[model samples]
Target: MTKETIQKTNPDKIDSILSDYILHDKLHQAVMISAPWGTGKTWYIQKKFIPSFESQHKKTWGVIYVSLFGITNFKELDDIIYHQFLDFYLSKSIHKKIPSKAIRFGETALSIVFANKLGLSSEDEMNKALKLIPQPDHIVYILDDIERSGLNLGELFGYVNNLCEHENSRVILVANESQILGRFNDTHKDKDKNNSVNTENIVTDEEKRIEAYYSAKEKTVGLTIKFQAAPDEVFEQVLNKVVDKREVQNLIRQEKNFILDLFTCSSNNDTETILNLRVLAFIDVTIADLYDSVKQYLDVFGKDNSFNDCLPSMINTAKNKIILDMVRYTALECFKFKMGKNLDGQSFSYLGSSNHYIYFLHIFPFVQRYIKQRIMNQDAVANYLKIVLKEEMVNQRLTKSVFPILNEWWLMNDLKVEKAIEQLEREEIPEGVGPEYIRGMMITLITLRERGFSIPIQHFTDKIIKYLNSMDKISFNNSAFSIVSIFANKDFIDLYNRTMKPVYDYVSQRLLDASLVEYRFLIDLQWDEEFPIKCRNHIASFSSDRRFLSIVSAEKISDKLKNANPGEIWYFCKGIREVYNISNVSDFYRADYETVDLVCKVIRDLIQQYEKHSLNKVKTSNLKMLLNLLDQTREKME
Candidate 1:
């Protein structure tokens, strides 16, 4: 027999129970023990009640310890108890009987054997059978972990009462009160003996029982023990246990101190304090994930030989530092390795890595400072100014300054420059900026030709032409309209047709449009003869204009050239160039190598067109200088 560790607040309480049983000859078939988890309810049954009762009496008692874990239905309960009884009565001999169809009936038959042997049988035949069997003075049934049995209190208590009616059994049901009481009330609602006790009655009776138990044990017991953990108690215990472990002690100490300070400074009471303490406990567990990797490293590589092995050097390195700072560099490297993102803005690879060293290094210093400040001063108010400063200095610098330079030098340089430029030209501006804002914008515009609106090109050109006409500038070469046209091809062609056609029609309507300069020039113009004569007349008129001549002489015309609204004449000139450039005829076709030769011809034509007939002789020198400049530009472009 072993002594049970039943907790009694008062020594007189146990004495009263012994007096009731011995002096008054009082007997109880069932007793319910209640307490919270880790509150020693099972300890009381096994260490105090069972051993003491067996030692005090001369008669033998059978003790059954049943754990009701996972006992879902009545069948499970019956099976568990039956198995427990078998173990308890291992020293006793009993007749073996095979079960038939009904399990419940079979269990009832087995229970009768113990009752009959105890002289509890009512029938004469059963009583004769009971006389033949050895009698046990008492049966001590200990149900431990009864909360897992899923039995309602009413059903459980009712079962105990029935067992008591049949056998000389003392039932001890040990369970955590918090897990059982709420469930019991929700499931069972009977007024008769079937109900264990009313909720209010149960509370009052439990208090009285607790009071009696404590009073009986008052003299012998040194002190009543409470197993529930208080916030401060748990904090001190965990901190003491972890602060010297070498591997994780530093981090755990910091976190523990943080939690303690939080509780000390908080206006809330015990419950809220415990909740916050639990949160800090969770953070400690997360920090341990980092520490575990460091431990593994040290274990694989001997600690003495690991990371700056020389004691003097290590001490020098750690000057003006806390213990947590010892592993700060390692932690940071681990975080980065595990959590860094690639240029594609994806995190899959980093998160999948075994070590998150870099991320740890980046975050640990701030976390360390936070813990140190909180613990040293019990600071309830957090300073966000540091966070703001870090965001501006560290994060912003890394993103804006470092990332762009690195991306351009290392990644973008590998891409085709021309292709990249084309991609940019085609890119669309997204509603909001994307992850690769510049690159994605360029690619999107290249894919979709239209800009902000997805309307047809003709509509966009019409809008631009209307805007160009409204501008104040009237000079054809310098107008904002010409710049707009050169930038926008659709607008250039539309405006060119509007401006050039009237000039050609006015000349063609009169016979004066004819001259050897026009007819012999037409043959020399070597226009793609396939075009209608009216189109050729338009081209000639456009070529004859001083503004158009000036633009041709410049070689590099401003974007404004496209916005001139040169009417039919300008469109005719563009059509003639495109047709002749692509044509197969020797005189009409221009070779790629001769583009400079053709550009020189266009400059000479522009000088002839722009110089007034009276000023032509004097402007010849200026024209020769201009031609020389064109020759230089052509050589450079080649």
Candidate 2:
């Protein structure tokens, strides 16, 4: 880059000096630019300096940029240089004269194309130029990744020197000096040829070895510029159009202490990588959502929105959750890109789009423990971080809050909506507000709204029953009912027809199961309008339970479920449906455990043969149902 332009870009102290040296017409020796990775050295030289140097310099006609990153030999290097020149000419639409000996290889399409660029308008001119090919002295060569090439360093240096000294072409070498030359060995201590060698001889030998190591570099390299790009300048250049700068800057200021501590006393290379990525975090929240700025809101905390507008979101793209999954995926990918392994030592790969769900929820808690929890309590998070990062289960339970549930789309399929509802029920409810029934009522209202039907609150259930009865393919069968079930409890009637009689029979049996005596009494008091007060008293008195449930003076069934766990409430809601053997488990007081097992096993076998749903599906659902039934015994819930 020109001195003025580069200075304006970064104001680095070295810009002017380097720009002046590059712009100078003197061509006594080659020049070298040395810098570590991510310093924008290559970018600045290629994008700015070369164009400026060629434009501003008097002697230079064209600049040739060649990266010897993986080139192994002189032949490979020659091919790259030639192709890059042709590309450069193709880009510029310019042609230069070439000597005859170079075109003597003959008249192939390749020769013609290259010969035409060499200013030979006809095949005769190309043949005439073929007998005496001369080096292009007007071209300046920029050889990058000098240390990465597999060619011998001393040999390569000598070649570069020959191009400058004999071919009269200007050369620039780009590399990291420290990376190319590691710490000097104690070769000074080793005697050369004999023990008679003195200290002065040893010193001279060491200097010669260091100089001769580069072979021609001592004489060929006239100027060596260390590329120390300014930090703020680099960030501004890289992130100017990528993100919302003002807002990210504020967030960064808030997190300045943490970021500073993280990279304090770190090596320059390590620090440089982190600085670039910290800039990335604000613009795009990485997998951990550590520095995510996008805010999220849920209909939680007994807010007005909870009842006024309740919609069961099956899939959530809530910004923070997306950031969490995104950052997690990115972190692992970064590791894999660098180290060839994920944090868990499994070599991960993306298969189309399955990666979106892979390890996301499983590792979210760990990410939270490390990146988030520490902000609240260092000690708590410290302990939590240890377990989670080690591939162990998290100490904290996976939160089942409404916000979290919204993002768990994998658990909300038509086959798994019941699990979603159950999980939602597991959240810590706000006091005195029964949101589930409100949710239920909202659901009913929304359905009615969609169907262009309306009913009073008291008449809603009756209307739903009437509507379902009006529809075909449903009825109440005999004592021995066909086993039927729906995936969601709320889908009880609206979702299925064949389940009516089987569900009713199961509910009646479970009510009389004797284990849930108080539960049965409460339901009778709540659901049956004509339920005799005398019968309710008899039922309540039938058990010496601590809580006496009544008919007219009955508490809402929801009140009893207020403190119930998700599993328990799930059981209370769908506890009877399990009798269909689709989601059955041996939690209730049944005839026998063996019989229940045998029944489930038979149903499972039938499912496997015909696989109506799936045996595995039944097993998974049954396990959930069993857990729900078990939790139902723990406490009353709403």
Candidate 3:
């Protein structure tokens, strides 16, 4: 019936039904398309159904659409419909002679002339004006957001009845009927308490209103079509609009069903299916952005040789796994976050059990940051990916060669143990090996030596220390240095006590000293007009160690606060709050609470200095708030 055919597989046959209704020469009543909100009813009517209808019957009928979302009275509705018809008439009568560029001006001039000439100030006058159309019967009027309209239902439906019966116009209404009924029911509840003279047998005012509503609907509406869209189909349509990358598109295509499953089930209820296309588009776009970042990260780290080395034939499989894991994570997290749920910790728990490269790629700290902030820190993502890739590769090498035999040493004979020890010795520890891996190796070797394997544990320890010394300063500072206490060996415990403990302590103090210097510079930069986010993140980079604290002296801070402008003072206070806010939760920042308290006292004196002057109100207020925050931090820490 229409140019764009609905698939025969679609059992609803809604397109055919609507086509028949629209093609009828005379419409006795308006057709209402009803669905729940966010079910893509509006999108279907305007984008798919209308385009097909128009394409099939061009010039035979004119289409006019109006949204009754916020219309509260008759005149607002009249004005919108009047303008649609005016534009239609202008296009047919006057636009033929006017150049395309001047048509806008011509329409504006004609609108003013017609409104004044017709004196169209009321609905009756507007309807009179609308009759000026060459063939009013040829126009098909589509009104959307009917449930959101503030107009009384009877009055609104009466107007529609006039158009259908008298003006001989076809009308289609798109609405969420549930919302309309729910609103009316809520109104009834509110009024039930106000009515004092309700007799038990009498039909009440609420019932009368509802009856009138249905009566008007019965008079005006010929057919009501319940609208339901397939979630998968709608998601496909939305994804096609938002995603252009072929790889991303393919990944989504492959996992479309599974992704939808994760999303529909993310509410933790198996039976609930949340099909919101607006949310779907947003999630697809987020997935594409995250996938692009992953691509760039992988590009920087070169290709994954893990698959090439271990399963040479499954290279494509490995690549797809990486992309798919990212897609799954992005989809689930976007759904959860946008739905106001906490991050799904279960999705990330695999990181603890598996050292798979795929698991490494699915680490979601960067993802959580991106989702919450709406800013992709590509450099940070790439750097973290680089670190994960290195660790995964090293872990793979160790797991394949040495770790298995060492971990299950009882199954290995004397020759196998000797070979494992030799492999451990020959394994030239990489420069940036994570401390966890290093400690694991040290424990295994020391245990083997204690078990009489002649493992040369001290030589291995020295080599590990040498590599730790050679690691880049930033990487070394960021290392987590995981500690395992399960081992009861005197030698391994003694090694940690004698060597590893002091090394980590020295490294921690060195990092703290360096961070204090950087913190001072960041404090000064905070007063500058442009405090870059890169700078802020660099300051927050030390947050995990809990050693991050401002070391600026109270005298210098007082001098800076006195000279700083309002915006500078605002940013400076923000930085101080952000830095000290962490001190509330961290025991490490407790040592610096005295310094913060002194700064608060300095700001108190500054506020007093500016309190008597009207010119320093902004700076004084900022200092006052900063002092309050510092005071709260001190109390919390105490």
Candidate 4:
């Protein structure tokens, strides 16, 4: 028999965690916190922990937060600490005079800056100000972004050591330890392991230097606490900064779990991909900035665009800032006006070469528009890539993989039979596309088929059938793709009805197994607070054709029709309407055709009588029925 224990980290309880770490300390010396970048090392301390400690009404004078990034020397560090110390004193509500010796130095320099008196040197004054700050137990010093600092390592560590031992200072060093260790070799060639970083594993001088640096850090930092912030909390805060929390929440409500599912599925448990804080922040801002514009465009013209490989490919790109930047770059090129001018070209300017940035932007949007316009030839793709980039930039192997990938993405985004036919008409389409690729595209087709696109995919469908037969069933029901871009376009729906219908049936059944299926039941069910998720399209799969949401003369119908209160009228008819009347749901059909149009007109008359509203308002009949139904149903249910 064996006993096992597992620990799941709760970012919400970070305050409690910090309390344990901080209160456990007896050293009154430096306490270092080490966390990977984007784990919210600085945010957690400044926002949550320090405020909490301050709120306790204990002996804590004030906290001074300083980021050491870009600090070039000891003098620069001294200046920052001196100003922060002064700011700390000034933060108090009550006015307090500086000590006599400090008054001239602190006030004179501060006034010079505020008054815009440029020519004066604040150097001697700043040094004097630094000496006056009490380096004792009255304040907490938060030193962060230390890994990026340009200050000499020995001198920096020496200053920290002297502060604790003689000045009675309490320091909290927040940094990424692995990152700082990596920088040590780059900066000090003397300790560069036998002149090569690759030889680091052999007991070399570089390894010794690394060990010595760790030893020095451990000595300077009396206690080390691993720090990580809750990604969810940080995401919420980041999103809330851009849009109202309720709106953002509503936008992703259904897909929130799906986005996380996408994240987990794509990462394959790679810690860097799954837990990277920077990526979390990037996604937050991306959704904030891109959601409304992309959504608006897609909603009106969305039939024309989809984020094919881009959405799932998010995981692959999250590992590098450059890859993430590529997404932003492409979006900016297309929708620059909406993007705001904050970027000012600085992000791209930092990249060593403009070729990668310029070429990717041109190629990315070209691919999206190319697929949307239904140009399916591999040669077309190759020629298009050539037009977009220089000759050397086109990697043939990459383009080969990318061409099919673009095709697969096409299926995911916008797969009307009209567009698909261009690609599907090849003498042997399967020869150019992969089984995995085809499987993914078929799942996209199954989704559009369910949503009511009357595509004639079943006639002579051996091309699709042969590919599907080779694989186990594709489960689209729970996929993120299954939840996006559903529409009621009868002109494009096949509804899984055709000669090759069995395959569609098998795939359809698999996908609809979890959805709210029956039109009557789906309607009659009470709307819970969480019912009708906001962002996700909960696509309906119907079991009937002449579903009655009709408004007609109250006279000719059965007594059952007249006796109906709005409760019975709306229940069973909310989403019920004739999309098309063909026996085969997927048959070549359009709602505007004679039979479909006539049925819709007749039904509209029936529904109008139920409401007793004027025919002039026929356009609002369906909506009126639902509103009246809700009013009456609430009365009935309550």
State the C-alpha lDDT per candidate.
Answer: 0.38, 0.43, 0.62, 0.44
Best by lDDT: 3
lDDT per residue for candidate 3 within 417-531, as digits (tens), equals 8887888688787544456556556555655665788877567767765675675564444234433221122344455445455556657766766666666665555565454
Q: Give one digit per residue, the lDDT tens place, for model 2 in 2-44.
A: 1112112232444566555544636647777776655577877
The sequence of per-residue lDDT tens digits that candidate 1 reaches over residues 204-265 is 35555454333322322222222223455455544444344554755555534333433333
Q: Report residue 420 deviation for candidate 4 (angstroms).
A: 27
Model 4, range 364-436, lDDT digits (tens) per residue? 3332332234233444544443332222122222332323343343345454444554444443433333323
Q: What's the CA RMSD of model 1 in angstroms?
A: 30.0
Is 1 or 3 the stronger prediction by TM-score?
3
lDDT at residue 497 of model 2 (Cα atoms): 27
Worst 10-residue lDDT window for candidate 3 reads 349-358
What range of 10 consecutive residues in model 4 has the weakest lDDT sum? Answer: 349-358
TM-score of 1: 0.30
Clashes of 1: 60
Per-prediction CA RMSD (Å): 30.0, 23.9, 15.1, 26.5
